[model samples]
Target: MTGSREALPDVDGSGLTLGDRAAIALTEYRNGNHQALGELVREATPLLWHTVRAQGVEHDAAEDVVQSTWVALVRHAETIAEPKAVLKWLLVTAKRAAWEAVRKHRDDEKRRTELPDDSPEHPTSLPAKDPLPDAQVLSDERDRILWSSLQQLPRRCQELLRLVSLADRPDYRYISAAIGMPMGSIGSTRGRCLAKLRTILDEQGDFSWT
Candidate 1:
């Protein structure tokens, strides 16, 4: 049930997608190998974070949802019915939890707004905030521009691109399922999204993303 925000390990040449590794991790955990679960946590937490964040959950609540998703995986390790689909399971669980959090926040805000204006609990002013803390820290102007351009895309495109960037290309089907996208067309959809992103970047300036 432990996790970290460390960068994903390079699995190039291993012939294993994140989905495959998730299945292996769950199977190993079921067989009393706890280390695999920890490795999965370290590797997959970023994916979970972004998945939750894409649901419009705030940063702090997204952190809680990600951790709870890992905990739920451990609790249901024996009854998941299909270990091969563990990555999709995690993404779905995190997304549902995020939706719940957003719903609860909206309910609370609604209640607050209904309160009397002079109520002690009523805020006097809206709070200012910085950008989301989980946003990638840009190292230069080009990186910043690329990130800005990314934000200009549709939310679905943003979610797809972020998940694919953090995972193996072979896992796109799992990601597509998690994000409610049609599996058969995810490849073409991703290609179109990338082309659109490149077009946006080009409009910004001649900056090499490579």
Candidate 2:
């Protein structure tokens, strides 16, 4: 008992992105801090969850696909060229993974057709198909109108506005990271995007950003 080791103090590792933490933890794992890698996986899951769902993968399959994406991340962590760029890589990877899940669903349907009633293909073939009555449809139509307006901007403007609009991170680091630009440029980009958005709305004849 006299020679027992002392316990370590707990530390909260905040102010970091999941990708940044994952990259650091991955380096730690390579250097022998095995437990840290697990922490990275847990932290990064939510981002992947949102991204996968955003890509139209249903909740359950998106969960599985995201888990597999992390597993793959661990395996490929060493190959990432720039740790600073990890979030974009993760997003792109999640999008690709989500699409892959969708492709698998389609393939499963094709195979089930070949195999008959024993295992009728996965039920995720159709996206959420809840029917909305007239009022609900009009409301949805309004949202679509706004979304379509955003898309009508030039490609750069569209990407920049989407970068700002879709981000939940208020720190701006995440948006800067996603867009591969300096943090200082984000505000200007956002302004230009807003102007373009307003112009699009004004030109629409029936809508106005005001």
Cα-based TM-score, every candidate: 0.79, 0.51
lDDT of 1 at 185: 86
Deviating ranges (above 4 Å) for candidate 1: 1-13, 115-139
Per-residue CA lDDT of model 1 for 1-210, tens digit only, reads 223212233435477888888977887788799998899999999999988877777778779999999999999998887777889999889888988998887677766666557354554322233254344567578878878888888868888998889999888878887688887789999988888999999999877778
User: In order, what is each prediction's RMSD in angstroms?
Assistant: 7.0, 10.0
Q: How many residue pairs clash in each candidate?
A: 0, 0
Off by over 4 Å in 2: 1-15, 110-124, 129-210
Best by lDDT: 1
Q: In model 2, what lDDT does residue 37 have?
A: 73
Error of 2 at 185 (Å): 11
